[model samples]
Target chain A: MKEERKKIILILLISIFMLSFCLLPVIYMVIISLSKNPDFLSAEKTLRFTLKNYFDVLSVRSLHFTDYLKNSIAVSTISAALSVFIAALAAYSITRLNLPGKVILLFFVLVVSMFPQISLVGWLFKLMAELGWINTYPALILPYIGWILPLSLWILVSYFSQLPKELDKQALIDGCSRWQILFKVLFPVALPGLFSTFLLAFIFAFNEFMFALMLTADHKARTIPVGIALFQGLHGEIPWGNIMSAATIATLPVIILTIVFQKRIVQGLTRGAVKG
Target chain B: MLPKGTEKSKELIEAYSFISPLLLFILLFIFVPVVGTIVTSWFKATTFLSEKFIFFENYRLLFKDVNFWQSAQFTFLFILVSVPIELFLGILFALVLNCTIPLRGLLRVCVLIPWAIPAAISARIWELIYNYNYGLLNFLFMKLGIIPKPINWLGTSLGAFFSLIIADVWKTTSFVAIILLAGLQVIPEELYAQAQVDRADFLQRFYRVTLPLLKPAIIVVLLFRTIDALRVFDLIYVITSGGPGGTTTSLSLYAYKYFVGGDFGYGSALSVILFLIAFFMSIVYVKLAGFSKEIA
Candidate 1:
């Protein structure tokens, strides 16, 4: 009985350690975000709290916090939607139709996915400049879609392949056209896969920083990650309070999306990774 | 849906139509840029705007560049140190998470929270933690009487390097844990039970049964992580900006600087080298995983 009790205590201690290790930075950010004093140490000693930093970050004219938030949302959502649509069409054609070189094509996707964006960004910058797309939504959105399409394709292809083939036969016998069967039959049944792919893509695009940073010059197209990283205080001071508040706000959407779609996200991510 | 009597050309056309949008985008955005990087690496830029075909000069310059060599060396050192540490921590966490415990679901979610947040944001949060004056580390250390003065975590070369690793490990170790946990679930309980029937202890059974089975998963995690770590940029860019006298600049960061300097030729060469390293590493991982499978 004593041995069992000791084992339980040890496990509990380790669990607590792991939990704190994972959560302390975020907890610290939250504390600093809500503190009245900019100095976290001072604030901890005093035990005072306020929401002023949040308000200031949102309302300050030069901060451009709202613009950053809007740009992040718009770029993430549109790119995710575009990637899902384009990738789903390709996945369907590969898995359902009699396409040649499917393996080579999938391999191509994997290789391209692994290609570092640092190499690609130079040419991308030149292209966007030629098209006069600097500081425009398409500049960032196009690259994001291209970057994330492989992941979405892999997830949707695996999901689609697992689906029963009998449904397709039935739809064909029902005299539905190819597009009709795809749009009306397979799509509705594949909503969960589609939804999961969308979530994963959205989170990735939202989290992407390098392309957003390099591609955009002003607040017009800057994302939350780049904006929050580059957040400047008047007179070139680092405003810890406002920075923490903005960081907290920047993280909220991805966190909430993750929690809400936890299972599907895990499944989509792992299924592609392990199986591939 | 193409009808039972459809010609092969018609079916091929249908498939082509379905795949054209993504194929076109990838060809334009991904493939073209890759080819461009390779081609541009062979040329020399006379000015920022003009270039000349100077085969092998960029590669030669990159090979001789002291900063590029240092960045490459540091990147390898970072990977060699960090990946193993991450794997060890990940396995421990996965082992704990695999056990039947209270609040298991909640713990899993909490562990994921770190990985879910963007690296840029996480780096910023850690920057606060590492602040010399009013940071959490300094405060906690001072409270515990560990040091007379607070340590400047990102203000020294050694401190900055390890600080970047700590932030990265914190953000990414959970992903490794998750992948390993998925691998753990596939491990049948009967193997453990069988080992127990022979009066084997926990460690003995772990060595005898668990490690061998988890090899493939470990390889997958290692490959993904090593490649990802090799190309790490934003974390370093945000945390130290490769500072403390340029001690933490990674290969990607080095490439990015040249890209920003309008020296596209050298930047492309640097990135090409980075890609080659990652590609070779993946091949090594694949061979290792395959060899282990044969032994098993």
Candidate 2:
């Protein structure tokens, strides 16, 4: 009994230690947010909690987080919807269609999926510049679709392929066209797969920093990630409180989405990863 | 008039049609641009857009560039430092979680919280924690009487490296853990139970049973992580931006600098080298994951 008690204490201590390492950083951010000491630069010691930073960050006339939030939502939703649809179509074709070069194309998608966003940022920047698309939603939306297509396709392909081929063939035998069969039969079955991939892709695009940083110079096209990064108060030093507030607020969408579709999203990501 | 066994051609065409939309965009965005990047690497670009072809001078100059070498070395070092350590932590955690315990679900949720939090956001969070004044690390050090003064966590090379590693390990260790956990789930519990009946102790059972079963999962996690870590960008970009005078400038950041800074030729050469290096290492890991199955 004494040995068992010792074992239990050891486990409790180690788990607490591990949890502290994980928890402290975020907890510290919250602490910094509430503290009134703006002179964190000077390294002073005064602890006062105030609502001033939250108000400043939230006020439309001040930080305009409300407008930025609206824009981010608009871009993220539209891009996510369009990208998922395109990826679904592509994935179906790759998995179900007995087309030429399927192996080669699948391989191609794998290789392309690994292409760093930085590579395209340079040329895409130039492309957008020439197309008069600087500071435009389409500039971001189109590339986001292109960028995320591989992940979506890969996920849906694995899920779609796992679906019994007989379901497809049976629908075809019932005088249904291939496209109709896809919409009515396979689509419903693969809905979870599609939804999960979309969530994954959307979160990534939403959280994306580099392209949003380079391509969008103005609030019209700015994402929350970029907006939060370039937060300036017409002063030199960064406002830790406001930055923390914004950072906290920015993660809400991802958190909400994760809750809404947590089951499918986690499964989809793990499944997608396993296939590769 | 088609010959018998022409069903192969027929099926192939259908496959092409199915994959056409994905293929079309891939060609336009990925394949073409990659080819352009490669071709563009050979050119003497007085301009970012100027296509006039040059010789191997770009590659020649790339080898001589000290910044390139420094960044490459640092990038490689970062992967070397972080990957094995994180993998070990991941496996250890996974092993703990694999045991039938009360509140396993709660612990699993706890494990995921760190990885789920954005790396950049968490890095900022840690920066606050690593503050020379009232920072957790410094405060703890002071309490322990380890140091008389707060060490500048982000102001020095080794300090920044350790900080960055902590953040990376915090944010990504869960990813490895999840994968290993999957492998652990796939393991037969019977094996452990049987070994216990044979009077095996913890160490003996672990070595005789658990570890051999963990091999495939470990390899999978290792391969995935090595690739991901090799392409380390956002975490580094957010926290340090290869700071403390380029001490942490990774290969990806180096590639980003040259490529976006309009030294496309040099950047392309570097990116190609980066791709080759990552690809080679990925192949090594895949093989290490027991390619004997494939051979058989």
Candidate 3:
């Protein structure tokens, strides 16, 4: 009984210590997000609840919340859809096909995707300027594909390899061409991978800041994360309440995605274990 | 059945055909850009550099750049400081979860929240937290009587770097925890059962069984953290823009400053250096992990 009590006590203490920083800090952000005045930051009083931030941010004409959300939704959705489609098709081909230099191709994809985004930001910045592609969706979209391609490829390829190969053979025997076989047989088998990759890609694209910050100069191309950052430096003093609400609103999609995909999260965790 | 000889050729062609489009995209996008980077590193090129090669001046200038050196030093310091702390925290957390703990899954996911957000977004969030005026950090410090005044966190070098470190630790320790936890799970329970059976203490079982089994995962976790940490930017850039005297300028950020400031040649050279550093560190990690002997 004593030993069990000690174990429980230790676990609770460790959890509280861990929570105080990692999770509590985030919770603190939420609290700040909900508070009315900036002065509440210094308030020691408990449960000083206010909905003013939420009301102000959710107001469409108020602080560009509507604009930011729209851009984030449009850009992230398109990016995700395009990436998953491209990645799935590619992953299917890489796995199902016995292409020449396939081994070399796979290795190259791994290195390319892992190529630090910060490394390419310069070259990309220069290229975008030269091509007059600055502040455009293509600027962010193209890079997003390059960034997420390797992982999507890795996941779909691994999953595709494990699938029953006879499904493809049967499709071929039944007079289906290669494209038909991939679209009909292999692609369907790769649904879980497709779903998860979509969510992952969307979150990544939405959360991207550096490229968005540099490439896009205005709200037209700006997504929520970049928009939220810029909101701080704009229009006299910082709009702390609106910034918090915008961040909270921006964070909602991912939180929902997390809850929905909690089942596959474990599988993704183990399979995509950090690759060197 | 189809004849064997013709069938093999057809199979090979079909495979090539299937993967060719994807291959072409990879080549045009990834391969061309990387090659462009290398070519630019050798040539004195601007954004509009459709001109001649000036081999190694970029390399020469980069070699003597003082700010570049400071950035490199700061980057190395950031990694060396942050990676071990994150690892120690990660392993410690993993040990807790790996043991018989209640609400394990709930706790595990909570740890992943910081990681799940983009570094850029999280950096901005931390900016609010670190804001000198109307910032929670200063508010707490004042209440606790830790300081006489609100410290200018994002306004100073040490302040920015420490805040960045705190954010990163919050963001990524879960990555280490999950990886280490996976490693922890693989140690046969019977070993622990027998250890307990033989009257071994918690510390002994961990030191004897867990640590040795955890070596490879720990090495990989260290590699991941160190590589990412050395390239730190989004946070610093968004928060301070590497300001208050460029104290927060990382090697990658310096490379970026030159590149965006339109010194493509010098930026590319710096990039080449960063790549080499990452490659070298990864090789050291692989060697320690004992994955080297298996390499071709």
Candidate 4:
């Protein structure tokens, strides 16, 4: 009983530490966003709560905060959907279609994933410039799809491999083409895996910074991260409240997705990183 | 019924067709850019200047450049300092989360919150938290009497370095924990029960059973975190902008500055150097982790 009590106390203490360590900055962000004075923690001032920061951030047309949000949503959604569909095809081939050099291909993709973004951004900048596609959605979306493919492929491959080979055999015997087996038969059963991959890929594409920073010239193609990063006050003073509010809003979609699909995200992340 | 050789070849063609789109995207976007960077490094490829072939000149300049060396040094030190701390905290969090604790799901969601948010956005939040007068860290430290006055977190070199470290840790420890938690879950309960039967205490069990069993996962986390840390850009870019005398500029950011300035040759050269380092580290990782063998 004493030992169990000690263990319980230990677990509770660590849990508290984990919660505070993970949450305090996020809480601080929200607090500053809501406060009229960002310097409320100073000796004389206190938190004077208001919704002005959020109102200014959202309603102010010049800020282009909503435009950034819209671009981010559109870019990330398209990139994630296309990346997953393409990776599913490749993964289907690797797992079921007896593709030659499939192992080599997987390793190649893994190596590509580790290549630093700096290595690619310079040339991509020139390419986008030459194509006259700078500050456009396609400029960001195409690279994002490529960047996201490896993780999607890895996760889906693992998920697909786990499903019995007999499913493919049965589908093949039904006079189904390879394409039909993948789309009509396999996809229905792998819906959860597909959703998980889509979620992870969407988060990745949404959070991507270097690509968006280099590819997009302005708010027309700029996503939220770049937008929030470059958010400056019209005057010299840093608009803490407005920046925090924008950040808070920007984080909402990903935060909600993560919390709701916490288990699926964890599974997909582990499958991509560790299972190999 | 066995298919004929031509039929087998036809299936191969079909399989290749399925994989072609993915291959094409990666080849164009990733592979071509990488090769282009490599090729451009051998030239005087500035925006205003005429492109001229100047093989190895940029690299020679890089060798003699002070800022390049400083950024390289900072990048290495940042990796050395931050990766170990993240690994340690990640293990602790993973161990806690692995236990049958109350609010386990809530604890997980809290952990995932940091990892979920973009580093660029979170660094802005950290920027506020590390503010001189009204920041959370300074205010708390002063109230607790840990320091006499608010330190300029992003103003001094050491302050900026550690500031970036703290923010990076906060943003990434969740990832390490998640990866390690997957590892911890795969650990058999029987081993712990057996350890208990052998009269092993908690610490003993962790050292003897858990550590040994979790080696592969630990290795995976270490490699992933190290490679990721080596390319540290977004957090430092936002928080300090490599300020306080460029003390915290990573190789990636340093190269990015050149790219922004339209000096693609030097930028590509810098990128090539970073790519080589990362590539070398990955080779070591592949060998150490035996990834190929495991997948096969």
The candidate scoring highest on TM-score is 4
DockQ metric, candidate 1: 0.55
Candidate 2 residue-wise lDDT, A178-224, digit = tens: 67877999889888777788788877677666777778877788877
lDDT of candidate 1 over B108-210, digit per residue (tens):
8888888889888898999889988888888888888998788999999899999999999999988888888888999999999899789876678889998
lDDT per residue (tens digit) for residues B32-109 in model 2: 666666666788653546566777888898899898899888887888889998998887777776766677766666
Candidate number that wins on lDDT, 1 or 2? 1
Error of 1 at A77 (Å): 0.4
Residue B296 displacement in candidate 4 (angstroms): 7.9
lDDT of 4 by residue, B24-85 (tens): 99999999999999999999999988999999999999999999999999999999999999
Provide the overall lDDT of each model, using Cα atoms, as 2-decimal numbers. 0.86, 0.73, 0.73, 0.93
* Candidate 4 CA-lDDT value: 0.93
Off by over 4 Å in 1: A1-7, A42-47, B1-5, B46-48, B283-296
What TM value does the first chain of each candidate achieve?
0.95, 0.89, 0.89, 0.98
Model 3 C-alpha lDDT per residue in residues B130-167, reported as the tens digit of each score: 88776778988887999988888877788888887888
**DockQ per model, Cα:** 0.55, 0.38, 0.42, 0.81
Q: Considering DockQ, which of the candidate structures 3 and 4 is the better prediction for this target?
A: 4
Candidate 2 stretches with Cα past 4 Å from truth are A1-11, A38-46, A61-64, B1-14, B46-52, B282-296
TM-score of 4: 0.98
- What order do candidates take by lDDT, descending? 4, 1, 3, 2
Kindly report which residue stretches of model 4 are placed more than 4 angstroms away from their true locations once superposed: B1-3, B293-296
What's the alpha carbon RMSD for model 4?
A: 1.2
Top model number, lDDT? 4
